[model samples]
Target: MGGEKMLRIVMFPWLAFGHLIPYLHLSNKLAEKGHKITLLLPNKARLQLEPLNFHPSLITFHSITVPPLETLTLPPGTETTADISLNQHGELSISMDRTRPEVESILSTQKPDLVFYDMAHWIPDIASKLGIKSVSYNSVCAISMSHVRPSVLPKAAATSQVALSSSSYVGSVPQWSRNDHNSSVYFGDEITLLERSIISLSSADAIAIRTCREIEGVYCDRVAATFNKPVLVTSHALPDLELQLSPLETRWADWLARFGPRSVIFCCLGSQHVLDAAQLQELALGLEMTGLPFLMAVKPPVGYASLKELLPEGYNDRVSGRGVVHGGWVQQQQILAHPSLGCFVTHCGSSSMWEGLVSETQLVLLPQLPDQTLNAKLMADELKVGVKVERQQNGWVSKQGLCEAINRVMDEDSDISHVVRKNHAKYTSMLISPDFITGYIDNFIKDLQALIS
Candidate 1:
């Protein structure tokens, strides 16, 4: 940053924690590069960012009170999708759309050099009115982005009215067909998300994707061609999760230490996507059948009062010493990085994928939604760093299926396991290498400078 002009950037990400965290990570990187970041978030969602330990001087938190949940006919304290049930996620997206005025007001006062927005479809127009440049900072991977972009799809599918499901579009890549949930509530209605994404991308001065050329160069290229806009790859801004262990983290760490190296399965389904009782039962039984040490963190599905109510009878007693099932929040990055973590059973979210890649742990993918399904495909089919667990035609995982997939990835002799471990090691070395990350950040800042100039 020597003799460089310091920039003032306004960042407004979607209301979800998953989206917010990545935006904060990017803000941190920009701040480190001598830029000032004004992060606009809902009051409650702003609380989620406080723990991330951002640079106090360069990054400022500006709270915008979201329209009350009660007024929106949504649940109280529902600032993010993580605070509500899956079915109610659509309301959260719609509710955020109502924050346009608040955002405009912030822009009017901040007079920032640029605005980096995610999923806020109306941002570009507002920024343009203020003569401020805007960039659509996508936190998702390039594969998912390209697959969803209409111009990248086949002519027939692209012209069709039906929204292409993630499995149908991405799984159909090459010669594959897999059933997946038709849509995701996380981004609201499928058609709406597509329209919004297209609008936002169309309006932005440039597109910033949280991916690297090594992983999805072709997709990134396709994105640039499709939109006819400059595409900037930020690589994956991996968050620093090496904070001192809390009491709960210490307990889990101590428990994992008892296992032999690379022998424990770490299962976390992220903040969203709770499991129903039947799915929970099958998953519990599956983990029990593995006969391997495991730690699972679950959020009980809708209508279930607690995790205990969702567990199968005597399930806890049966797997007493072999497994631990804790409900609610868990320090996921700490668990993934633990020496005993043999495999990661994940929902295949982009952030989780980056963490898993950095951890060098084999991935056991259990994708619960559309974007996750696409992520699973890229990890298993393209990257070859993970194994997607087999699900029934109706898209449900059984006890045996889960056990077999977990065992397959854990087994050293199996070809899938071997390839996954090999690829994981290769990618991990590249990701953690100092040169790779530094070069990526340098290029990203160069792109931002060009945009402003």
Candidate 2:
């Protein structure tokens, strides 16, 4: 313990931005703890992160060259953010496989005290063989992790044992269920990777989650018990971004101002899940019918024209000033923290949901595939902090239903909004801070120190 000095940590994230963002934030928090951080990603992903220009001395980005593989011939007119099949990029496995040696070199050279890895291309095995300690970091909630376990959910008739069930929603893996739809319905590749993670991490060191214990305390405990590993539930409380409001950004300001004091509806489906044409039209009609001052961050679907064409009649004209449509990513934390943000219509991604919850903003859940559904169920049912939109067989959200759901959330009549806001505020305040997470890193380093001592 005497020789335990400054710690060095390495992070490897999956290719997608959704997977990268949380790991990047975790790297930031760890760096503040005086640990040297090397974040490894594919070349394109590294380029995407360059603009953030994080602290240089403490943190550095390394690009893994991808081996040339067959191009993923996506559907014509398919948006990159659309809900494509997980196996759509099976060809890219070559690239990931090629990255093994480069990453191994980084580990051998740095000899970091510990490695923190995203549930990406199963690199923890590489880390384990190198004799480096590693932890699996999932951006989703514990419920999702619980589902990824190699067990099927309990029988529908076993009501009493439902909470303890480890039934898989979409597969043979067993997991717990929150609703009737909790059957075999998750990402097969992600499940495979996660199960590999569970096995690889069993003897490694510790498992850290980017969630608060309060929000998913019971589930987190269950996960720790099942995996037989020490678990850390870090909150999503990031340092405040120093942003000043500008009126000349007329679109964002005008839309936000309409929600004056708690009237605006902020809608986003996250970066990965963009709605198709019909779903977009339904959402537009719903927002127009509610007449609520709304700001929708529409990441225009693959085949859709402009946002205006996708909405119901007059949705464009009436909501122009009252509502703003952003086709790309916006500064989400800033928007959530805004005083004018009255309600959130989100896809229930764990990070986005946690941010909204902490900001004391109400939520409207329109979840897509994978762990999102589980997270939404927890938000809407277990926590009583959001509303879920029902879907049809083709997965189309009805316009009238969307309108009704939004109206119910915005209406002062229903106590759901108040309850959601109240609960969100409570969770936000209770979230574990960055310093607390650094403490965990500190402790993990101490254990490593004894080895090299």
Candidate 3:
């Protein structure tokens, strides 16, 4: 470490909370190591990170205005993808692409040593022109990245139809070709983000992922080989602060306290995906059939004013004492940490996967998107810490399938449940070990310093 200079790093994450939060966490970690960081985010998106406390001396927040919604044909004040419907994500990506000038302006003024950019393909080129090194930071896990490498993806056929639902999209999840090669074929809006991710990875000096080798060691090795770049794992990024429960959280805590230890299921799909009326009804019926106490956080589909409107008739009264359906955001981390919370019926996003793993909550994966499906496969097939709900050939999860998955995970005597619990315990201990995070971060910083030097 002799004669090494402290670096100035610029962090530019994608316009999504999932991506932004991790970047901010990484920024905080870097700041703790005495490096200066300037985080560039859209004006509104910056507000979401304001609540988090960071080392003020080393970390600075720079807000860049997103392109006008009118030009993008998006809703007013739509700065982040969460502000818009899933169908409008491509337009949001287009808007994000237009911020290159703002990013370049900041780079010109700040003159940072290195820039870490998310899946924005243009940033790497800009960094190159400015003679600053750039790294691609993928918020998704290594397994998803490895499976989606250009060589591994399937070629789209001319006759390929637009998928009816996100779940039906063939290339969204990893599929094997006839030649025994892992491949996926993306169509429509998925192509835009996928292309950007590929380009960003291809253009970067190196790549960083928010994962640890303990969980996805093979995938990490494969990703480094496929991308032909130094891939650094930032370890599993956990919440920087302990969750402070809100009034609603207090109420839910009171309700959960009545349940036996590890008896309740916490069902929440991550922010973006909204279930259609049919899927909602089926899920409701499935949870009702379990008769186990559950707290479900939902965002009703378009045209539904509230959860009551979207849920099935008499559903509330049928499960009144045992179930609570709270609309809008809930304190997911706090709930997961609760002792009564036995299982998490999750969308299998990286954040949710880490949270569930750390909380030692059994995972019942109902993956709605491709990346999530890969995460589900990792948990269910590779890690043996979760079970994927059975989906029909058309990728539909029926009420029976949902019920079976929940029952299987909750059943203490079942082999799957026992294994899941054991694996969860093993992983939780490893992740929370004192040296686990510190050692990875130290090695990561040393590697970066070596590269730049």
Q: Quantify all predictions' global Cα lDDT against the true fold.
A: 0.79, 0.63, 0.78
Measured by lDDT, the strongest candidate is 1
lDDT tens readout by residue for model 3, 1-453: 346688899988888888898888777777777889998888777776776536778888898888864744688888987887776766777677678788889998888889998767668777877878888898888888886565433333211121122222233323421111223333223453455555677678888899999888898899888767899889875654354223336677799899999889889988778888888888888888898998888788877888888788888999989998877877787888888889899999888888888886788998887788889999999988889999999777898999999999899899988999898899998997758887888888887887687
Clashes in model 1: which pairs? none
- Give the Cα-based TM-score of candidate 3 against the true structure: 0.89
Name the runs in model 3 displaced over 4 angstroms: 1-4, 69-72, 151-191, 240-248
Estimate the TM-score of every prediction: 0.90, 0.80, 0.89
lDDT (tens digit, per residue) of candidate 1 on 1-453: 867788899999988888988898888878777889999888777766686736778899998766765645577766777777766666777778778788899999989999999778678778887889899999988887785555544555454322233223321221111112433323433434555565667668898999999998999998888777899998788755553223336788789889999999988888777777889878988988899999888887778767887788898898788798888788788888888889899999889988888996779999886778888998899999989889999878999999999999999999988899999899999997767977898898888889999
Better of 1 and 3 by lDDT: 1
Between candidates 1 and 3, the one scoring higher on TM-score is 1
Clashes of each: 0, 21, 1
What's the CA RMSD for each of the models? 5.1, 6.6, 6.1
lDDT, residue 424, candidate 1? 86
